[model samples]
Target: VLDRIYDFERILTRIETGTVSPKDLVALRESLAVIPQLKQVLSGASADLLHSLNDRLQTHDDVYDLLCRGIKDEPGLVIRNGGVIRDGFSPELDEIRSIAANSHAFLQELEEKEREKTGIKMKIGYTKVFGYYFEISHANTKPIPDYYVRKQTLVNAERYITPELKEFEVKVLTSQERMLALEYKLFGDIRRQIQGHIPAMQETARAIARIDCLYSLACAAYDNRYVRPSLNTKATISIKDGRHPIIEKYLKDELFVPNDVTLNHEDHEILVITGPNMAGKSTYMRQVAVLVLMAQAGSFIPAKEGSICPVDRIFTRIGASDDILTGQSTFMMEMKEVSYILKHATSRSLLILDEIGRGTSTFDGMSIARAVIEYCLKHIHALTLFATHYHELIAMADDSPKIKNYTVAVKERGKNIKFLRRIIPGGADRSYGLHVARLAGLPESLLKRADVILEDLEKNGGAPVPAKAPVNPAPSPMGDSLFSSPVIDKLLSVDVSSMTPIEAISFLYNLQKDAKEGSGIQ
Candidate 1:
């Protein structure tokens, strides 16, 4: 009931805000009513009942009709005729009928009050075998006075349940004490009749519930102006410069700056993105993550075109904060998370780690970052995106075969920096912190001082440079030159392959001494 009411409120909001099309609203209404019909059938009938009646009643609509009539008219008829039944007729039958009739009336009234409180219109339908029931409405009518807005507000404002209403409910129950007792007796018989069909009834209920859930989710997605991504696997995550769905929709005209990112099993296994603060790195990552989640949950994504690899698990280590209560520092928490990923991530997993080592000092962070990249490259093989300010981490791709590096491009026009918000191959040249500081309303003198400090730090190698080379470089003809350079001549001349293991160790020690003493030659 709560879910249905919530869905109805969402639909109403959309209709009022012009976010939902009339056609969609009609479809939503129709879809919303399916579950109630399913519940009615599942609640009242047994599997044998359904099987026996299957040929006679082929459609869900038929079942719905039966429930509506059974609840509304049949029970009353049985109760009214109970007094006139023949001598051989059971008196309990009439008494059961009366209880059912009263219960049905009470339920109907409750449903109406609920609809009024929720601003969801309900259509009551009937049939035989199925008890009386109401649908939470998918009906459309010609515009009536106070039709959309007034009713929506009333729906929003009306209390779902109040103490006064609870009191009235108690009174209703007290007044129907005898009928309730009789109904409880009849409920037992009904349960027995339907016992054999429990599985079928459960299946029917599940199907209806699923339909209801899907419809409600779809309606909510549509109401929030969520764009439906095509359910195909073209390895395309194309949102035409679209904004983050959640952020953009709520903050109109604020411009979410859509981006396109694609990752598949083939060429695009990993994405390494680098950008300045507030340039949408986190937002973009989150956007993709949310889309993947939405898709998996059987929802439409907010993108122009999105084709996703159905990932098994999504691991995110994005934001930074200390657990003061737990007395764990940010770095400790990060390591804890990273350890889990390294241990558990599989080939099908998707990982997004942002500023992974920022919780610690530069050297420590960079070293840990290097080890992590190497580990990911060799073990725990998964599609990963490591976003960081420590550009030195990108160098892992040089030695590791599986790693890749990418940077979010930024445009610098003189003293001004324009965040392009474009992801490209290679690492970032600088963090551009000072430029960001200026943008953050820092004083000109302080900004200049920060720039001077930044330049000095760069000169002294305090800041790491971005990766400009291809992460997955092709094999070079001169690969052997790296090992055979003049610096290692003494080590090479030792001929360790010809020596026994013990002798080889001695030779290596001697070669290391020779090299240290500058006796090694090209």
Candidate 2:
């Protein structure tokens, strides 16, 4: 019933302006009539908010019944019309209608008598151009009655008006016009009375709106099997069996795998998650953030269990998107989002980043990612979840006490890979990017070639060098020769900072010449 309330302001406006239609009046009455029952139901509510709203509600039974009795059961739209008001509402209106009914019968009888008296097939007609006139054909123009005054002439006919007809038209039109004026005045009075109660109706509407919202949230929790989460101010968020609320709902055939998350400002402020492409690292990170958001919003969280310290802000840099019209590339947009997060995130904030710095080359991207992780762990101390393909970043756990390493588990068959979607302790040993590519339908020849190149890279500690390419140049003769010079030893041991600029330059020039001569290069 509360949810059914809409367009109430429209009703109040129409009533205030004396333009209240039958439908608006009926809707208003129906809404007000439901108030007493609504109050009764709310009075028994367990929540204090609902009970308080019940006390604030005003039923206004007088106004409700006024609309019920004063207006017809199914009144027409216009109030100036007679059909708008009920028959018994006004004695004056009823008497006028009775006179008008008798007048209609009288006019019909008068037309029949005139037709018999003249025997010229006379007809009674009314039109806005000429009211209550008798139309006669031209062939019957002979022996016309003088009492019938000619009013209008047509090509083959003539129209005439009689004094009796004129008097009857005046009485009928006068009564109808007077009755309509009375009806309009009466309906306007009733609408004005209802308008006075608009404030109370608005208040009731507000209370019902709040109740509807609460009911909707409750329904979501119940239908989705969510549990209430514990909240505190301790700067920690921990959840057991946490699953992505939205993803889990859309999943078919396979159930979502739940994972555990733990983060605290003191010891484990930042968690570095590494795994293959589809191993659920991003999903696990997002689940933690969602649970935190829900708990802060005072709604039940979609987790088996959760206890979260309220975060001041939640920031995410998860997916890749470009603002093409705004002239920002994907990498630039990613950096902009990262910059905002780093600038605003506090110790009580929750930050979720996925594949940060992945838009650049391997070495540069890894370097930047490592620096960002260090900054967050050392300076911000925010509860952070970072999912990345950079497995080397997991080694930061050895240096930073607040950095923890975790990985999504996977199973490797002989030639196939299976994603377990489970977060486990420690860094992932391998990334399985090629396996993911294979799953994505990469050609077998390409996969095999990639495997060979990867083997060469591992052997050479970098990208593979061509088999025909010359090996590393023999050790530089300058290395052993320069070491044998006493001047070199002296130069290495000297406090160059203490020397004047000229003296330092002179020493450097002589040393370079001697080193070149000693190596037999000059």
Candidate 3:
């Protein structure tokens, strides 16, 4: 019924032209027909909103009844055809239809009887120029009756028409013509009668549309176990155990870990989120934005409990996207969006920024990112969720009470790291980009070389390490790194089982000699 209801405004607009088509009128009737069912559906609801919507709706059975009685059950797209109006609705129309139906039936009977008697297999046919006649093929030499008056001749057959058949043909053709004209007139009357109820029906359409939206929202809330988030006009947002509405839905065979978020006009205005790649930092930030928007728009949120206030607008600078149409690089687009946000955002606005100033050189990117964060904290003061890999900026949180440091927790297990996907207090100190690459299936040889380079960077500023330490150091829990030095690395790489006794003696002599001299150990 809802699908059948066409645009009510279209009906109203068309009536100004003085007539509505049968298709439009049928659509209008369906629009009215569903109103009673809608009211009944809402009748048992306790919500005053649903009750108010139900009150706006009425049965409109008068319109439905008029249409049911006047129009054909399967009234086609046109009114000019004869079947558009129901039979027996009009006495004159029924009389005309009866004449046409009975005439056609009689002609069929006459054709069959003559075929049996004459055994010529004759068939009744009609033409515009030749009215009605019986056709017999040249192959049939059997005789026809005396009443079969000659009419016309074909190249291979005889054509004849009985006086009785000729009389009924006139009645059939004329009644059919009158029947179509009458149906067109009757369909017009129905369309005009509906025009009088256009205002009421359009109002009801609005009510039905509202009810449909609310009902769908209710169903989603019930099915997804969504909680109702409280909404207010203040500039505070606090959500406990908040899950990403979208990401949680697609997590197969694994559960989504929900995180808590808190933001206010003052102290907790901006969050500097730092975490390793794929640690759910982006997911966490986006959920805070999504939940706030949902709550403000009167929707239940995907959280245990939340209290959100309406923001003037929500601005985002998320992920890597280039505007190829305008020849803008990803960094250029990032800057443009950030510029706009900084220019317009008020304290009440919400901003979800992921990796701002990430597309340039490391120092430049870090500087720009820091400047942007500072501007947002001191100037815009908007509620912000800023996710970045730049651990250097975590210090900003220490300086200002408005900015707070948060990280998605990570756990190191032996040589591998596991992303816990939990956001907690304190900033992440390392990115673990190599670990993420390992998970993404980088070559082991390349990863080993990269790990060596990273170790060098952290240890000796990427310079070549000497053979060994100048002095002995304490043993470590981290798998004997002192013995795994460059000299020891070569030692471990050798196949000791394959070495001859003489070769093993030679290798031991070289190591002892290298250990005595500072550079010989290499």
Candidate 4:
């Protein structure tokens, strides 16, 4: 049984790697399901061989049957020494000969009796090669030669008769010819039946392939020391030393770095991961998602013996892109994804949001990020790993008991950043974007300019503020016109502190419209 499981694993790996199609995977799965039942009938190595043969036979039976049905009309076809034989004398040849002779004689007598009663002249000829003889019953009795009887009987280079038994031979040949034609009709019927059911046959084959794939996956999981992780009605994800199987395989010589993460019903439901760019935060989040999926799908996960409370759904919002053609900025796309996750994710779900709200201005992005964390904590109640550069979010751990803060550790030396790629219990010091920029080949002059701009921006309270209006302004009708539009009214009514990330977006759009309409407020 264990060995069978191993075989099943290999089959599934092939499927995962695209070496086998889904149809083949289904067949393999069905074969694995039968392995346990077949174990009792054969023992030891014999059992293994039998199981292997059964799998092959199940897979190839359709093709073999199609070929056999094509030739069924040729009556002499039979199994000989485990191989197919067509029309050759054998040990059972005498018995077949007797049956053919009797059949022909009966037909000949019937023909003669009918002709006598009707006053119609009829001629019957029999031969062994034709399998039966033919009966001629026509009013125009043309001169029939000896060669005519022999020529009609010959088919595919085999002689129909011997001279010694030529008379009987022609009669038998005629009868055989009639029988063969009838057999051919029956063969056509069978072929039609197969053709009609081709769709169903293909479906069944695909189903079997899926079964084979499952069996193989199960087997491989067993071999790799993989086990089914636990799941509960509550939302919780916990894993120890879990490695991403695909990434590990690609690394080849390098050892895979393992990470441990835990989200539970009591202590923590949300984890805010803050780390420098490229420090494995996203990879860690993805690993957890993949493990949950694997466990729910009934396959062993790549972990050093871990347990997970089953997730109803998995959502990942990891990358950034602008919808320029759609007239949506990068921030709009980010808000759209964030809104989707918050709306759809449930307590039994797992959410991975990497760098959410990073596309907007610092204050707006930080405010939006704060509200998102709060919503997940207070409303969705799902297990979440929120990876971000917003260090302010780390404070949520102090305020909310359900939120825990974590960071992927990075070693900083003077002006350099060295990614450790290991998760640790704390918050990140900074985003280190400049260090990464340097590594990306940013010119020294550009870095210097960026530093100068950063200093000026920090001195002016992080962002530029408009100069205050003159104290002695008396409002005219035109000045009042600046703030009277519907768009401006809606923007003024929006309260960012109270609204979630999604609501803030609607407010931002209304504000933008107000600005476009010659409103004074920006």
Task: Report the lDDT tens digits of candidate 4 across residue range 1-522.
Answer: 323322433444443443533233343444445544444433343445345544532333443344443332223432221122223323243234444758556566755764565444545554444543334433335543354344352333222223434544454545455444544444334335445544444444444455555667767787666766776655667888888867766776567788998998577788999988877898899998888888887678888877777777899898988889989988898899989998999988889999888897888889999999899888888888899999878988999888888998888898688887789988976788888888899999999877677667768867774554799987653345446667567757767699988888877876666555553543
Per-residue error (Å), model 2, residue 70? 9.7
Residue-wise lDDT of candidate 3 within 1-522, one digit each (tens)?
355456766676786466666666677677777676767778999999989998988667878898878876577776666578887789988888888778778788878887777777888998999988888778986667788898988899889988877877877878878888888888777777877887786777787778777767777789888999887677889999998878888999789999999998778988999989999998898889888878877789888999898999999899788999999999998999899989999988999989988899877899999999989888888999999989989999889999999998999987699899899999998899999999999999989988877887779643665453557775443333435476677688889999999999998887666554533323
Candidate 3 is scored at a TM of 0.70
Predictions ranked by TM-score, top down?
Answer: 3, 2, 4, 1
Off by over 4 Å in 4: 1-63, 69-191, 195-207, 219-227, 322-325, 455-461, 464-522
Best by lDDT: 2
TM-score list, all predictions: 0.51, 0.69, 0.70, 0.56
RMSD of each candidate relative to the true structure:
26.3, 14.3, 14.5, 15.5
Q: What is candidate 1's local distance difference test score?
A: 0.59
Residue 162 lDDT (model 4): 30
Q: Between candidates 2 and 4, name the one with more favorable lDDT.
A: 2
lDDT of 2: 0.84
Q: What do the candidate models score in CA lDDT, each in turn?
A: 0.59, 0.84, 0.83, 0.65
Summing lDDT over every window of 10 consecutive residues in candidate 4, give the lowest-scoring window: 77-86
lDDT of 2 at 379: 84
